[model samples]
Target: MKKRKTLLLPLARQFTVILILFTLCTVCITIYSTFGYSRLQTSFLNNSLESYSAQLAKSTREAYESYENICYSIAYSQVVQNYLMSENRGKSYENYRQLENQLSNTALLNPYIIDIAVYGQDSTFASLCGSASNYEEFSRSLSDSRFPYRSAGVATVNRTLCHVLAMPIYSLGTGESRYLGILFLAIDVNNLLGNSLKSDENDYDPRILFTDASGQLIYGEPQLYDALCREEDRSDVFQIQETSDNPVTYAVTGYSIPGIEHTLYVLIDKSQITRQVARISGRQLLVMCAITFLALLFLFLLYRPLIRSLKQLTDFMNTISSGDRRAMKEGAVIHQGLIGSKEISEISTAFNDMLIETEKLNHTIFDTYTRMYELENNNRKTEIAFLRSQINPHFLYNTLTMICGLAAEGMDDKIISVTGALSRIFRYSIKGSDMVTLEEEMSIVRSYLMIQKERFEDRFTVRYEFSEDSHDCLIPKMVIQPLVENAIVHGLEKSLEPGELLIGAGRNPEHGYLAIWIFDTGVGMPESRLTELRESIHRSVYNKTGDASADLEDLNSQNHESIGILNVNSRMVLYYGTDYTLLIDSEEGVGTNIQIRVPYRLKSDTNARAAQNTNSKGENHVPGNCD
Candidate 1:
């Protein structure tokens, strides 16, 4: 018998290769079409700019010619020539009136002509239609000109920007053409060029500019003229790429007027072309996506049987890998009875068997992990409780010793006060919850400070600063009192002068954390001892093991003076992690500042508990008040 060939796998490989090639070809075609379309659009824009610039140049030339003809007619008219050639031109009213009439009639040819004037050779002059304040200057400029028949450039006339046109007048009826005077016409630039440059289309904003032979702006925006002059190539048409200051790109074209020394430029915004290309490219991309989708659909139909079986297996494996406990417990397996190929049937059978074995192993591992997590959590809680217990005894021993000293002196009133305050401290510390509101915490701190005041007498005073908003923020119990006790014993007791103990509680606006600080103005420790104490506290926080109670015992044996601060640091780290640990700063002569920072949290039943605690105590809680 002849060996049979399997065509399914090879056919699938070929289909993949075809899809990849199709994708590459589609990308190449899109890129080529976009590039070609951009170039075509740019060319079309350049041509449009060129045609528009020519139209502007034509309109500007016509305006110039019309104004020049008016000057020529006024300069050569018999009435104006007679006025300039007369012996006494300014003195004769009839001559002035006739001369003014001729100039006025000639200016009527163009409404843009704002002023007309004629100067005589003997310092005599006549004006019509506008001011003649600068007629003498105009005449002198013309007479001193290298070319008397040319324009005198632009000037301001009657507070309006105008183009000055000068034409020389000679004595009529004379054998020799003798110089008589000059005729001046002040033409309004805005009225002349404004209509010609206004664009009718709204797609692109076009800017028209006119510059003289020396590149100075004759009319229009000086900025556009300056940009045109900066171009290295003086081509008739070019593009100004987008700039930082001016985000709009422009296609610029220049045209020289037929009868003047001025060049006109038309700048059309090129963003319109970019928008057009983007729209075209978008359409092309849509069509390509549709074609690709149809092709993929056809391929999927051709290989539906093979793909369907593989997809089922893939989905089941994904469910198991994603740790879906419900699916694993239900023992969902792929039934291979529907599979047509022997190889796929074998794969389905092996996968089903492997899933059964994996489910069993998964349960065993999960049970072990759960047990480990529970044991670790319980150990951490026990360690924190043991740390809290350590603080109560250390504090009570000091208070009891002070009470004994007071009894020896026979101070009955002071002894009563100390015992009462100690009673309040004991009640507050022996509460069930490890967390309490900051208001309750500060209340206990006040009782502790009151007892210290009785023992020290005039040796130290207490000051309290607390924000009202931080009264209800939750913090670990017995955290602040230990630091306060430490400061009194180690810091204030050694000082001879009267010292001040500052206890403050507030919310840190920067970190949104509750802050409690104890500061003492007494003798401080040296840097060496401060470093050693800080290292010991941090080591206790990091070296926690399964047995935190044992760790606390080891910490207590190392340092006597630092036990209170170390106990506070370790408890905070255990309850709130290392981020809420205590920060200690001290100087040899300045004293110590121990600050505790904890996240701002409030217990859900804080109000109810607070009311209950207050009712039982028969008094309202007062924070930071010592009498």
Candidate 2:
């Protein structure tokens, strides 16, 4: 139950945060749509109408100026001038006909011009434009009676409003000129204004109106213009008006033509644009709500399974702490509790891998420490066995028993000498230290040899050569005694003649090693036996240390003279790291010579008894290459 609460707490917090942010975004969008969309709709309509009105004003003004240019061109022509200057109005009919033809040609080429005509009150040009009453009255008031062609904004002509251009003719040649009649071009104003705007038969389309300087409505419905803009707003370029019939507001845009005093009005009903924006806002709000619903649904559905996976992981961790290693290995480290997060899955996988590796490492460390402890124990036992081998229990019993018999026989000197040697041997072997001065080790060697001589009944002769400088050096305790024991058990006891045993220690001048040699003139070892012994020593040093207990068991099994030599070799290798070993020379009928060389270790014993400077030489022990 606690695990469920722990997992759901984070998910609940996450969902709460997301819901708040999503709601805030929806609110902001709703507020923006409510007020901002309506403002944007009004702004767009105003800008569009303003552009359209500017276009209409520019195009309508150009049409008026074009008609004025046509009238001016005809009035300056040679045909009209000649007709005005001619005296007889009837006989000079060709000039009048020529002038009439020019006016007709101009009217035919211009579609907007209703007619182009010339009137000469004094001359014979035809008055084809019904009448020109205003042109006649204006001509009589002129000093030269010549009117320049110009735009007269808007006036009724032939019962229809038309734009008029009046051009007066003169008797124009190179000489002095007199005024002729006026050439008046009447343009249909209604036609131009009607064509300037797009047809607004559809009520939704924009309605436009053009008004002259005197406030005469030229185009579009007057009702729409008045409803959209007030008299004051019409003077402004852009304005808005609210209507009474409907709550729809209208946009009004007006532009003035450059040369003429006429303004173009463009009106648009803003409610149509409002309805479009409202529909779009409604759809957007619906979609947002739907998306919010789906998001909530997805998060709610996620609760159960994600919490289940988290609970599983929590249980797995608890089991791990309780030491259930098998369960940890079999459980999935990553699953759907990831809840769309790749990083959490990666962390789970890494932790699982770490635990697996840690377990392996723990086992490896245990095995390593176990082997080290066994090796240390085996080294202890080997040293113990070596000390005891030098003073065997049975040998001590027999030696004491022999001394008693000899004392009964009244051999005081032999009993005392043997007992002293036995005492020194035991004292040397019982000391706890493994290191001893070389001279002390030699003393133990002499003691052991004396005991052997008394037991052998004068069957072997002994020889010794010693160097005083090398004798003070330190060596492992009882290292040399094992080699001497092997020589006696295998050499002197087996020879038919009185055998010789040579024991010597010296500095090897060539190798600078402290060389100790043991030679015996007993029956020499066969080459195969010598090889076998050498192989045994070498194999023990290399192969046996991995399992010291196995070596001990093997030693217990073997009954041979090689064990002591093998033991010495193992101890040497263990101490000196494989630098010291035995070198043996032998002949089958002669004797065996064994030499041991060790790195010259200095005497650590500062105040020890001096070695006996004596040699009982039966055979010379050579100090150089004995091979």
**Quick one: best TM-score, which candidate?**
1
Worst lDDT run of 10 residues, candidate 2, spans 609-618
TM-score attained by model 2: 0.40
TM-score of each: 0.47, 0.40
CA lDDT of 132 in candidate 1? 56
Which runs in model 2 stand beyond 4 Å of their true positions?
1-375, 390-409, 453-469, 496-500, 505-515, 542-550, 573-585, 597-627
Name the best candidate (by lDDT): 1
Model 2 per-residue lDDT tens digits across residues 51-82 = 65677667776776676577668878887777
Q: Kindly provide the TM-score of model 1 when superposed on the true structure, using C-alpha atoms.
A: 0.47
Segments of candidate 1 deviating more than 4 angstroms: 1-304, 317-326, 330-358, 391-398, 405-411, 604-627
Clashes of each: 0, 0
